[model samples]
Target chain A: MAERAYIMPIALRLWHWTNALLMILLIISGASLHFTDPVIPLIRFDIARTIHNVSGIGVSVLYIFFAVWNSATGSWRQYIPELKGLKANLDRQNYYVFVGQLKGDAPHVVPTPEQKFNAMQQLTYIGVMYIAMPVVIVTGLAFFYPELAPAQLFGFDGLLPIAVLHYVAGFGLTMFLLGHLYMGTTGTTVAGGFRMMITGWHDEHDEKPENEQP
Target chain B: MAAIKTVIWAAIGLVLLTTSAIAQIERKPIAPEDLKNIQDSNAKCLECHSEGGFDTLNREGVDKDKLRDHLVDLGVYEGSNHGRVECKACHVKGFEEFPHAADDKKQINWCDECHTRKFLRIEMQFDESVHAKEGIKEKFTCSTCHDPHVFQAAKYMNSPRDVVRQDNDFCLSCHGSDQSFEQVSKEARPDLVENHEWLPNRPLHWNAVRCVECHTPVSKKVMSHEILPAEKAEKRCVACHSADSTLRLRLYKHMVSEERSRVGFVNSMILNEAYVIGATRNVYLDLALGIFAAVVVFIIVLHSILRIIAAWVRSRRNG
Candidate 1:
């Protein structure tokens, strides 16, 4: 039997699932708005615009809760690994993905109570949540109240540059989402990662103990 | 002897100069048949009216300001819709004589005289405009905004950006310049920027759209001339930010045909002029992003397949 650990708290799990739903809504609606067409419509322009605005505002509000909750609980540490530890973890991950995976070896790191994310996961989450999310939110607010944006940015209309920034950040987050889903499969079992997120119980060992050995 | 020599030379120079000047002034007399041709008549009028040599209005001792008012850029006039119309068609009254009658100065053409049928709606709207109010009506006229010599319809212009520049120029020519605004209005000229402090990105909005988009009433016509009071102007940003932006109906009405011709895309035409955030879309960006996402998904699926195959082989070897 495998050892178990409770890593995903109920509050964290709730926030995670809600954020996921909001992100999905925002991405779909954002795509619909970007490619608005009458003939083969993705979503009606009016509806998509409303959904995007609403979801964007919702995500922004939820992000405030995330920041405050993470800070209060000291869970933000999981997302900001020490440089020395991160370098070591990253080197191991690099080798595991490139060399070890081809040799049918298991991942070099696993989620534990002390560190919820591996080095690469921590870097990506920090970027998406702390940096890219803030940028997207600020730019979205500028769009909503365009009169507030600087009249000129680098000799271009302030909204022009802000719009580009918003699109790029959104694109980065979307690509992160694609990679995150794929990486979820590389755990003790193919479904183990997904089960942990849902059940909040990480199976500490592989289904077959032999697979845990090099 | 020296005085005699100087006088002789001066007298000869004066005679020669007078003869040369007279020769320069000489011109072929217009045949009676040529008088019937509008082009010949236009050429005759342009000889004195158009900007050029030392013989036009400058030679007539007209002040610089007055000369500027009368001189028409022949190129612009030729390119205009009224290009083919004979000068005499519009200048029907006192323009025949060289020093034309002063009384006929008031014989300036009124737009309604010729544009009665085609511009009936605009004329109606203009009559109801704030500019047409009792005291201001006498000072305001069609030529105040529309220069007959260079006027071109927004539809005929190359792009929406050009249309915005041209249309805004009409309003700014008066509202934007203190000299021009004071010429028509007795009221104190308000500072345009100061008045629009509440507006976000004032310069961008001013450049992207015409003043009339907010100042004028929304209408089914290509343009509305019934200018509302400042307080009555659209204050809500959603008027233009939403999917059914009023800009589509008012400022961008001319480009509606172009947009419709694009078949599937909505608000693509607006992208050519300005990005209205939610209202505007870029198909190229969407396509590229779509392709990127598709490739990412394909890679994920391929990786998942490989992982499944590896696990199956490992399990079989263990068994």
Candidate 2:
């Protein structure tokens, strides 16, 4: 049966869009600073540095708000990957993405208010939000206030290793974003996922089987 | 009649001498512009020295080892900052005639004569330096570190890298080599590398930055010639790496202006020019990020291609 569900709330949608814009700005400005010579004219080195720092602080604040909001709404559970259905979810998701979709098979998982993300999506988001983002943010702050940080950490000079960690985390985050963008296109229509994210609802008819029509 | 004749002769002699003196005073004075354009008289000395000057023995027949101390490399001197100035300007009180007297040949140049006004502040600071306090000032004159003829302003150096190279080279010329070290310090000299055990990556640090950057105490927009003791040298990495580094106050003050604010996190514009190890952003990190993004894109494209091929084969088999 075709169903209609309000998976994303207005506040969540607003936070998501703002976070996305800030992440994009941070990445661009950080890139400009990293490659200083033959400067990116869109934002000069000084301006880019200012933007990167400001956006970093903005993203940090937004991340805290996201955590608080997720906890308040009891929606944080959606990102926690449960071991009970993990293997089956992974197998079905993999088959659907790699082979079944090619053969016109219906998707195994449907979006609901309780479980908005599939097992793969849940795992990926957990790593990005909890691991990558935190590492980058902490290292960035350490770099900003080097005086307070230890001169050496784990037998290496703190700042260089911290910088490397931040860079590597940024790389991981960038890859996650790429994968996220590609996965968005795998919906019923190219823009269907984007529309669902913008509005709070997803039309179940897009993925429902024709033989099982209500 | 004899007395009157003698008086007439004396009067005539006096008048003739007075007229000659007055005529000498009326002679044309040399124009200041002409004096400026006057050729250096030291060119005569360069005639023999310009060839294999330092390699040849002195007129006093000093040994080859001691010959180097007496002989000047004319080629190097000719290209120096003081090349145009007459040697007699500094080597005054001697060399009025060729083959100067043995005692007069040892005349030392007085730096204070011309530099008193220009270098008064530096001189004052130098008087308070460890070198002066320890009575080592006589051993290490201006020429000990800076060769007046060859020395160029750090600002006019080809690049920042070149400035750093020359500055380190000047310091290492004495500290790094035994021959030069013996000339300055009578105390048993410590091995340059061994003495710097506290600094990690010592050679790399030496090559990348000026010795004065760390050794000299911080002064506003200028390198303090009053070098600090080795124990007092700036050893902390945060001194240069932090937002409020003294590097901004001294070495990189020119980069800071009204455009840059202390509130701006990236007020230290020196990071734009050089990769300051831990402090500045690096190109290698950018390259790695780029490669990671490319690989991700490739994976997505490959998966899409495989999916399209699989779909085509399945449809053909069904038909």
Indicate which candidate wins on lDDT. Answer: 1
> DockQ for each of the predicted structures, in order?
0.10, 0.08
Q: Which candidate has the top score in TM-score?
A: 1
Model 2 CAPRI quality: incorrect
iRMSD for each candidate structure, in the order shown: 17.1, 24.0
Q: Give the worst 10-residue stretch by lDDT in candidate 2 chain B.
A: B18-27
Show where candidate 2 strays beyond 4 Å.
A39-42, A152-157, A205-214, B1-108, B111-289, B306-319
User: Cα miss at B4, model 2 (Å)?
Assistant: 99
How many pairs of residues collide in model 2?
1
What are the clashing pairs of model 1? A147-B200
| Model 2, span B1-319: residue lDDT tens | 9999999988776345322210111223556664455344675555333446544525554344644455566566644556556777877666555565567747746676788764787777778776777678888777667877677555433334566776778888977788887887776666777877866546556755687888888887467778776777877655665445566665555445522321122432453333353245444555666787888899899987876686688789989
C-alpha positional error of residue B295 in candidate 2 after TM-score superposition, expressed in Å: 2.0
